[model samples]
Every structure is written in structure tokens, then in C-alpha cells.
Target: MTNDQRDPADRPRSWPYAAAAYVFAVVMVGTTLPTPLYGLYQEEIGFSSLMVTVIFAVYAAGVIAVLMVAGGVSDVLGRRPVLLAGLGCAAASALCFLFEGGLPLLFAGRVLSGFSAGLFTGTATVAVMELAPRHRRGRASFAATAANMLGLGCGPLLAGLLAQYAPWPLRLPYLVHLGLAAVATCLTLVLPETVRHAGPRPALRPRRPSVPAGTRSVFIPAALAAFAGFAMFGLFTSVAPSFMAQTLGVHNLAVSGLVVFLTFAASTVGQASLGGVPAERALPLGCFVLVAGLAAIGGSLLATSLALLVAGAVVAGVGQGLLFRAGLSAVSARAPADRRGETTSAFFVVAYLGISLPVVGVGALSLALGLRDAGLVFSACAMVLAGSIGIWLLRAVPRRPRPGA
Candidate 1:
């Protein structure tokens, strides 16, 4: 149904929608809380740098697997239940981290975290939009997206500060998240469900992600932008801390976490800045900015300059923020309501692949080329991909026609 056709009762509840966003934010914060702690994990566990990426890759594996198999489950079962289940995953992940025994528990925690992220990434986003009034759709998108970045950024910052000053570096961060997750889980119980009709729940089955024929013009470029943007994300979240501590000689855990936080903060700013941008222009413009940011990252790595590195991260974050939000918003705008969930799943499947596969490749390359050189290589690859996406969006695809045009 069109926005006008939505049930009157479904009209956005501003406060409740904000509440849902907060719940989602809390869950995401758990996913990235370990960003700066990887170094400590490496030191305490006696693992190689390649092992670090492999551990992170395991988390991405869980996310990709869940996205493929169950990405549409919230639509089938009820948003709150699936979301609550996600919160459970978040809490379980925290517990895993709090009681980490060795590599095995660490792996388990990341996998559970991934499951939580995969469950919420698309599902929570759509739920927030669904809860918004017709006019607040844009704000809903912003709220969901910003909450994601905000939570993700905060996780590391909180962890970094606590790890730096607290008695139990590893245990306290996850402990704090456990409390937050419990609070979020309770808050989630009160969110009004957005899915209607109360039909028997569909069987949880994995459908191969598919893009409708005509939407490819918009979808492909959008997905490519997501890939390039997420590749940068993979770099920062997985290996950037190690890069700083080992190659750049910045060993402060708080500083490392702050750098990651800044990248996400820039992304939130970029997403917010898109409010006035016309739909057709936002995607390509975002692609161009992503390329520019990738170049800065490459320069930072080559020069071994911390300032340049942070600059690269901020620029990349902005581009990534713009690219992903614009891409998702555009894709959702063109989808038939019946198939919107499936289409969204497909978009994320591609996007998550971007996040994972290339990151693992960097890890493998780091084994041979070393971390700094490997990062430079990733930068070049992502820059080329980002540029190509921008060119394709500019030259080939027509804008999605306006509603009622």
C-alpha cells in the first residue's frame, strides 16, 4: 500500500519510533566494541596479525549467513520478536566476551554479535520507517541510520575508555554492554509491532537473493557503492588498530578507539547532510566522495602519517554514510511492497559480501605484503570500484521516476 493507504493507526508514533531506534542502537554498539581490543587479544592470545583478520572474518561469516537465510524473517514473524531475538544474540555475545576463555570463546562472541547485527541491520531499519508517519519517513531513515553509526561509534569509545582506565580491560566493556542490552531488550518489549494481519508465520527458509529486472539500473550501482564503502569499513574495524599500534606507533587503546569512532561519526554527519539532496543526485555524488576518501586513506598508509590516516577515515566515513543511506533509500523507494523485504535482503547480501570477502583478502595479503602495504592495495582497489560506481550511476541509469509522475 502507498503511504496514504497505510492504516491510520500505523501513523508514526514519534517517541516510540525513537525508542525503537535506541534499542537498535544499543544492539549495534555491541557488535563493534572489540575494535580496539583486538590488539590486546592478539597479545594475550599470542596470535598473528592474519589470525586477527580471520577472527573478524568469522563474525562477518555469521552476519552474511544470517542475512542470506533469515533476513526476511522479521516480515514473516513480527518485528518485535525477531528484534528481541536479536537483542538476545547481543546479550549472549556480551556474555561470551565477558567470560572469554580463549580463541574459541572470542570466536563465539563475534559470531553471536554478527547474528545480532545481521538480524537488526535491515529489520530494525525497516521497522523504524514503518513506525514513522508518512511525512517522517525521511527522519525515520535518518534516525535508524544515525542510531546505527552512533551506537557503533560509541561501542569502541566506551570500550576504549573503560579498557584504558578500568581494572578488567576485557571484562568491563562487555559487562557494560550486557546491562545496556538488558535495558534495550526491556524497552523493545514495549515497541508497537509494525507488521499487520497476524497471519500464521511463514517458514524460515533461505531464498536466493534476487534483483527485479528493471531495478538493476538503480540497484547495481547502489550495491557497488555499498561494497566500496563497506570495504573501507572492513579495513578500519578489523585491521586499522593494529596498523596504528604496530606501524604508526600509537599504542593508546583510547586513541585507537577514538579514530574508529571518528570514522563512524563522519558517516553520521554525511547521512544527515543528505536531507536536501534530490534522490537522483545523492547516489553518484556519494560515490565520488567515497573515492576521494579512499585516496586519502591510501596516502595515509603510504606516508605512515597519523593525521592523514584520520583524515582519510573521516572522508571515507562521510562518503560511506551518504552512499549507503542513499542506496538503501533509493532501492526501498522502487520496490513493490510485497517484495520489499526480499529486495532489501538482496541488497544487504551484496553489501555484506563487500564487508567480508575483501577484508579477508586484506588479511591474506597482509601475511605476504605486510599490513601497511596490504592496506594501500585495498585502498587502490576500493577507489577504482568507487569511481566506476560513480561513473555508471552518472552515465547509464535513469533516475527512479517520481511517485504519481
Candidate 2:
């Protein structure tokens, strides 16, 4: 039987997929909840900017590790178990934050968040898409992807507001998430399973990520587009606050959160814009736009203009939104039916690496030359990489006939 052709017992009748999408979003929301609060952590723990990146990198390390070892387990054991494991890790992460005293707890919390997200990243997207009726696949895709970006966008905004206005700056946000996660866990319990397997439970083992035969050529450009876009995410989530404080003289946590929020919001707008353009066109164009956004960011640093910074973030976010969604959608379409999970996990490993490695490089550079110069180097390198991807796509991928005739 096909993956989507499940028995009636496993099929949810009334919007279970929608409910799952919300759960997916909430899980993702927890992953970035620390973005705006990193500044406060630095104050409480007395760490360098480099240490902050290290903390975030730990989260990415957990994510990549999970992607490698356990990412495809959902296909065998069942989605519910994998998702429950993810949520459990998320709750543990929240607890770590609630009791956070120093770097160890902080690192532990982020690593848990990473594991949670890695579990959810491919499973939730595939589950939501498969659960939908054939006619509603498009809307389900939107629900899945939108939930991700919107949830990520909401994380900092929620945290920033609570941290700025509420007591227990570090504690309250995670508390709220913990409550939400409890509710989500209950909901997940009732949601019908979408993957049906009749064999003994598959052993969990470390597996390498690979593309299906004939898909490797397409996979490269798609992975590259996702990498470039996620690099934008790494910058925004990791150091946008520092940029605002030291470079632009802005200290409002809410304002800083809003800046990060706008980038993801712009990404959603970019995804919404994908309707008119073909995937091939959208993918390459999105990369080009990402390069442009980085150029704007480079200019923003040189000028010390907050407005330009915001503009760059929004622009880059839109590009990221378009490129990533387009790339994933295209790659999914080409992946062999059975190995789809492996293929998607591989793509995400690249994307998450983008989010982790480049930001660490920037953090290292900051310790040496300073934030502004490091930012300039960061932007220049991003532009070079993004530009190369765009040019390669245009040349390697065949051009489609223009929309009309």
C-alpha cells in the first residue's frame, strides 16, 4: 500500500491534519524562544559573544545528529512515537531554561530544542501533507510550511514582550510554552497515525543521508538554495540583537524581537508569492534576491542605519522564504516514494548547517575584529555563495517556456 493509503482507523476525519500542523508550529516555536533572550543569558552567565554562538551551535549539533541517527525512524516505528520524543525533549528544554544557572544548562536546553526540531522537521511536514485529502494537498502544504515560519516568527515576539514587560524574563516564556506543549501533547495523542507498517519495529541506527538515483543533480541546487536562505536565519536569530545594541544603539528587546519577526514574516510573504512563478524560476530568483538582501545588510552595517537593517532582513527573509520552500517542494517532488524521508532529512541537514556554521564563523570573527567588520565579511561571503547558486541554477537547469505562450 502507498504511504498515504492508510486504513480508516488511522485516518482522522475532522481536521486532524490541521491540529497536527499546529502542534508542528508550537514545537518549532519553542526552538527559537531563546533568540531574543540570549542577551539576558549573556548578562546572567557572563559569557562572550563567542559563547552565545557556541550555545546555539550546540542546538544545531543536536539537530544534525538527530537528523543523521533518528530522522527516518518515524517512517518505521511510527510518527506518534517520534513526535512524542520530540515534545518530550522540548519540555525538557523548557525545564532546563527554567532552572538555568550557567552555560551548561543553556547549552543543554538548546540541544534539547534542536533534537525536538530535528524530529519534527521532516515528520511533521510529511505527515501533514500526507494526511490531507488529495484535493487539499496544496492547502496542507501551505499549512505545514506556514506553521513553521509563522511559529518561528512568533517565538521571539512572544519572548521579547514577556521579557520586556513581565517578571521572570527567562522563566515565563518557557513556562507558557510548557503549558502549550502539554496541550499539544494531548492533541497529538488523539491524532490518527498516517504511516502504516506491518513489520517488526525497525532498529534505530545511524544512517547517512542520500538522494535517490537520478535526483542528485536536482538535489544540489535545492540544497544550496536552502543553505543560503537559512544562513539569513542564522544571522537574524543569533546576532541581530547585538547588531541593534552595539551598532545601532537600540536596546529595546521588543524592538529587536520585532526585527527578527519581520524577516520571517517577509519570508511568509515570499512563500505566498510562489503561486505565480514556476518552481524553477522561483528557486533561482529567490537566491538572487537573497544576495541582494545581504548586500543591503552589508550597506546597513556600514551606514549604521537601523532602517536599512530592517529592510535588509525583510528582503532577505522573503528571499529565504521563497528559496527554501521552493527548494524543498521541488526536491520532494523528485524523491523516490520510499526514501522520501531520508531525502528530506538530508536537505535539512544542509539547511541547518547553514544556520549553524556561518553564524559561528561570524561570532569568531567578532571576537577578533569586531561586530561590524565581521558582519561585513559575513554578508560578502553570503552574497558570493548565493550569487553562485543563482547563476548555476540559471545555467544548469533548463529554462521553462514563459508563462503565457
Candidate 3:
């Protein structure tokens, strides 16, 4: 039989694809396991709310630093080595959290977690998508995105349960995560390496944030929408629990974790919906929906209503998920094969910036204006930013041309 017409069983198995997806999911979950536990840390360590934001920002800072220096290293060094290294970093981060007693260790743990996630974000997604069966690429894309959101959502939920119901609430969660990291590391070693390179590994060079020239025009508006969408996510994950407890009188950790999970779960749904829509169209629609969700969140903060907050979280989560997938598909489609890894990394750099910078602003505002008012201000600002970007994307992005037209 011709190569193209060979039996399906003759093709490489797809279990490795699923395994990579699971490993990346585990890594993403570890990054956010500390979310619900932040409250515990504040109480145990005797730090102010502002300090929580500072510590969270340290994670973002570490992610950006790594994205700049080593984001594209996997392209040259191969996906497995980078992924294994990232898992190692994650294991180290978990150990730091297990031993954490003060602000310094918290900062160090988050930075290490950020470093680990920065490594995994680009490499894992590419690995999964590349390994997918030709006919199942669309499903694979959703799987990759679902794994990300599911992992993130599970982190807080798992931590909250263990923290609230188990012995050694603060310590147990990290130990559990440490165990997962060990398993993930072993899985990484067994997975087949995707990148084929015959020469010695390239010397580590300083990473610079960049995308392919062909993708730049489309990348700009997509990145902007992602930035705003991820900022809303960052706020929810990092500070929303504090708002719920302090401003709304909801102090239950499980409930708080559920609230955060709902948002990310909605994002998975949103990303899945994009399978039926074109990326060019999905980009603007997702941004507009995201803006509306932000407005709802601001309204919820003003009214001090739990229902409103939950509704806003769901709406914003869906929008963020849709836009994130759109951005990923568009960039990946336009990028040249040789530079695909770097291009994907550049997109995530913008996405992570959204996760970091705006949340830090909210933290600063909380210090000056109080939590509820600060949330209102943060939501309003994000709405305005999202709305502006939506308009730009709608006007600037061209309709998708017919294949081979």
C-alpha cells in the first residue's frame, strides 16, 4: 500500500498524545494549587492582603522571565528534555511549598512554579497537537485546551477539599501535588520524543519574545484580546476568594474553590464551542462576550451579590476560553513549521502578561481603595480594554480565505 493509504494501526499510536496532555494538565494544576491556600498562608504567616498579591505577582514575574529566556529552547533542545526539566522544576516548587514557613519561601515556591509552567505551556500543547491523528486534530486542539482549564480548575478544588477536610490542611495539598509531579516525571520519560535532531543540543541562549513575520498582523489583535481575557482569569484565580470571604461574608474554602472552578470549567466549554466556528470570527465574538462578563463582574462587586459574581465568572470564563483557542489556532495555522514552537511561545507570553500585570494592578488598588471597590475598578478597566480590542479585531482581521484560493 502507498504510505498515505496505509492501515490506521500502522500509524503511530495516539496514547502518547493523551499521556502528554495529562502530564501538561498536571503541571498546569500545580501552578494554581496555591490559590485557595493563599488565605491559609496569610493567616498562618501574618501577612497583609497586599502581600498576597505581591507573592502571586512573583509567580507571574518568574513565568515572564522564563518565557523570555527559555521559551523557545524546546524548539532546539527537543520537547522531551524541556518537558522533563519543567516537571523537575515543578517537583522542586512543590517541595518548597511543603517546607514553606514564611513569605520568602512562598515567593520562591511561586517563582519556581511559574518557571515550570512557562516551560510546559508551549511545549506540551505543540506535542499534543502534533501527535494527534490527522483526522482528529480538531479534537486534539480541544483536548489540549480542556486539559489546561481542567488542570487549573482542579488545582484549587483539590487543594480546597484537602485543606478544609483533611489533616494538616496547609501541608497535605503540596504533598499530594508532589506525588503527582513524581508520576508526571516518569510519564515524561516514557513518552516518545517528537522533535528529531541529530546534532548536539544547542547552547542555551537568551530567549526573546517573538512570532513569525507572516503571523504578526493577525497575532497583534489576537494577543490583545488574550491579554484582557487572561487578566480577568488571573483576577479570579488570585484574588476572588479574598473578595468572597472579606466582602461577601463567604468564608468556606470549598465554596470558594467551586466558584473559581466554575469559571475555568466555563472556559473549557467556550473553547470547545470554537470547533463549530472559524478562528477569525471567534476572536472578535469572544472579546465582546468577555467585555460583557467583565461588566457583570463589576456590577456584582457593587451589589455584593454572590449570584451575580457566579454569573459573571461563568460568562467571563467562557469568553476567555473561546478567545484563547481562537488565538492559538490562528497563530499556529499561520506559523511556519520551523518556527512553530517559538510562535506559540510568543502567544503565551502575551497571554501570561495578561495573567500577571493586571492582577498586580488590582492588588495595588485594593491597598488604596479597599477590596470591593478595587474589584469594581479592576473589572471596569478590563471591560474597557476588552471592548477596545474587540473592535480592533473585528475591523483588522480579514475573513478566512478559501483553501488554495
Candidate 4:
């Protein structure tokens, strides 16, 4: 068949999508660069555990704000512009950290990082998918997700090692990220615009979160699973370091970062492992695994055993990976094609809430009961929620894959 007559899916994809994935990774790296350094910030700045959670939550707030308000701006503004804007936010966030002014700058940096993340999360994923050759779309999707988790995983690892062994513990990691962001910016500039608008630019506006009437049943369980999984992530990123230093007496910054990275790495693996599990069974199974991981975490806290803590993180991370991907896939499948994007946004808002709100609660609990106790409470609560959601899914959803499968 002639080129015009051939299926568009058969068309060759350019290299820009790969470059776009790299850009996505770089921006995400900035979002969590400070994870391992939070303890350092606390010591140098003299903040309470509550303040640390607040700082981390501020980033999530920025992310949710942008996700709710301007999530779809790329469809209107074009992918390149939105991506560059995200990179700008990331650079600004890095600069905020590099300057080291105090609590205000830390908060500002995190919020800016959140804005960058919020902007990147939807836009970059779409950009990667849109730019890829139709045949390579599956790989593109995996690339987008892997970039996100791996980038997030790498941040703590990078920051921790640098801070622990290198000079300028607080400043160096951000500086390195700043250099990477500049490179990502150059890449974004060159990437072909994936959104092809014919006439004048449409006015950018907020898209309210919506769940179609038909998909509500699947949406709730999937969203809750995502919430539980992200809550685990939030716990690790925000407070795990403090727990390591104060309760465990494990002050090696690199090890702390390594533990967080292991969870994310496990999550990436879990996402990859999803193809093996029947789609119908993925969510419930993931929840059970997550509960087990959370239980291990709680045990680690009670015993102050670092080995068990790492084991729990890896297990929970895998569960999180499975729960997040499976829930997302099921929801997207069930959602009306026209409303799929809207539904996914709503799901993410819930997921980000899991990451932010619960961590803050842990922070509050820490003030009254202490960090170890706070963690145990958090883990037990997460386990219960995950377990409940898993059981419900098993009962309500069928044993076999639905129509889409």
C-alpha cells in the first residue's frame, strides 16, 4: 500500500521520543533530590519532624494544585512549551535549594519541584506516547513510567552518596541536578511539538476531576489501592530518613538513600512483573503483597532492625508498583475513551493525596508519640486499608480479565 494508504501505526517513529523520556527522567530526578538530605536540612535548619512533613507535603500540594488546575494545558499550549516550563520550575527549585536560605527557601523549592512534577507527570507521558511510532507505543508507555520511578529512586541515591562522602552536603546534589535540568531543557527545545494545533492557541484552563457514571465501581477500588501504595512511598520519602537517624542510629546517609531507592527499584520491577499476572487478579494480589510489606515495615520499626526495614521496603515497593500499575490499567480500561484522561487525573489526585496527607498525619503522631511509634501506626493503618481494598476487589471483580483483556 502507498504511504498515505498504509496504517498510521505502521509509520516510522523518530528518535525524539527517546530524548523526551530522558528529559522526563531528569525533571523527576529533581523532584526527589532532597529526600536523603532532609535529615541534613533538619539538623542545619533546626526544624521539627512536623515541619519536615509539611515541607514534603507542600510539594504534593503544588503538584495537586497544578494537576487539578492546569493538567491539560499541554493539549492547549503544546508539549514543548509545557515541558520547558516544567524544566524551568525544576531549575528554579534546584536553585532554591542551592541558595540555602532557610525554611522558606526549602518550602519554596519543594513547591516548585511539585509544580515541575505536576506539569511533567501528565504532559511528558502524553508527549512520549504521542511521539513514539505506533508499533513502539507499548515501549514508550513503559519508558514513561520507568523514567518516573527510576528518576525518583535515583534522586535520594544521588543526594545521599554525595552528601555523605562529598563536600557541600546540602548544595552539591542540587547543583548536579541543575546541570542535568539545563541539559533536559536543551532536549525539550529540540523535541518536535507533539500537539498539532492549526489556528490560534486555545485559552488554557483547569479541567475539573471527573469520574464518569459508568466507571465509578472500578474507579473507587483502583483509586484506593493507588492511595495505599503512594502512602507507603510518602512514608519512605518524607520520614524514613529521620527514622533511620533518630531511632535506628543508622546515620550513613548513603544507606538511607539506598533503602528508598530499593523501594522504587522494586516498584519498577513490580510494574514489569504485572504482565505475568492476569489483569483481573493483579489488583487484589498487589494489595496483599503491599500489606505484607507494610507489616514488615512495622516490625522493623518495633525491632529497630535495619535489615528488616530494607526487606519491607523492597516488598512494599513491589506491591506498590503492582497496585499502582494494575489499578491505573483497570481504571483506564473501564473508563470511556473520551473521559479516560479525566478519570486518570482524578485517580492521580487521590494517589498524590495518599502520598501527602498520610505522611503529615505520621508527622503529627511523631510529635506526640515519637517517630518509631508514629511509623508503626502509619504502617498498621496502611496495611488495613490495603488489605480491605484487596479483599473488596477480589469479591467484586471477576476472576478472569474483563472485556478489554
Candidate 3 lDDT trough over 10 residues, lowest sum: 1-10
Highest lDDT model number: 4
lDDT of 2 at 392: 88
Whole-model Cα lDDT of every candidate shown, in order: 0.85, 0.87, 0.84, 0.89
Q: After superposing candidate 1, which stretches have Cα over 4 Å from the reference?
A: 1-13, 133-137, 198-205, 397-405
What tens-digit string does per-residue lDDT give for candidate 2 at 55-102?
888888999999988877787767888889999999999999999888
Global Cα lDDT for candidate 3 = 0.84
Tell me the lDDT of candidate 2: 0.87
Per-residue lDDT of 1-405 in model 3, one digit per residue for the tens? 101222323336777778889898999889989888888888888977678777888888888888888877776777889999889888888889999879888999999999998887777877777667666766776788788899999999998889888998888998999888888888889977666645665566775778877789888888888999889888988998899998888888888888888999999999888876888889889999898788888888888888988999999999998888898888888988767667777888888888888888888888899989988888888888888988888887676799999
Per-candidate TM equals 0.92, 0.94, 0.92, 0.94
How far out, in Å, is residue 60 in model 3? 1.4
lDDT of 4 by residue, 205-288 (tens): 688878998999889999999999999999999999999998889999999999999999999999999986765699999999
Clashing pairs in 1: 12-133
Angstrom error at residue 291, model 3 = 1.3
What lDDT tens digits, residue by residue, belong to model 1 across residues 1-405?
312223424654577777788898999899899998999998888887778888888888888888888887776677899999999999999999888879999999999999999999988987777777666775777888888999989888888889998889999998888888888888888877777644455566677567887677778888888988887888888888999987889888898899999999999999998887865688888889988888988898778889988998899899998888899888888877677777888888788788778988998999899998998898998999999878878876576899999
Q: Which ten residues in a row are the worst by lDDT in model 1?
A: 1-10
Error of 4 at 163 (Å): 0.2
TM-score of model 2 vs. true structure: 0.94
Q: Which has the better lDDT: candidate 3, or candidate 4?
A: 4
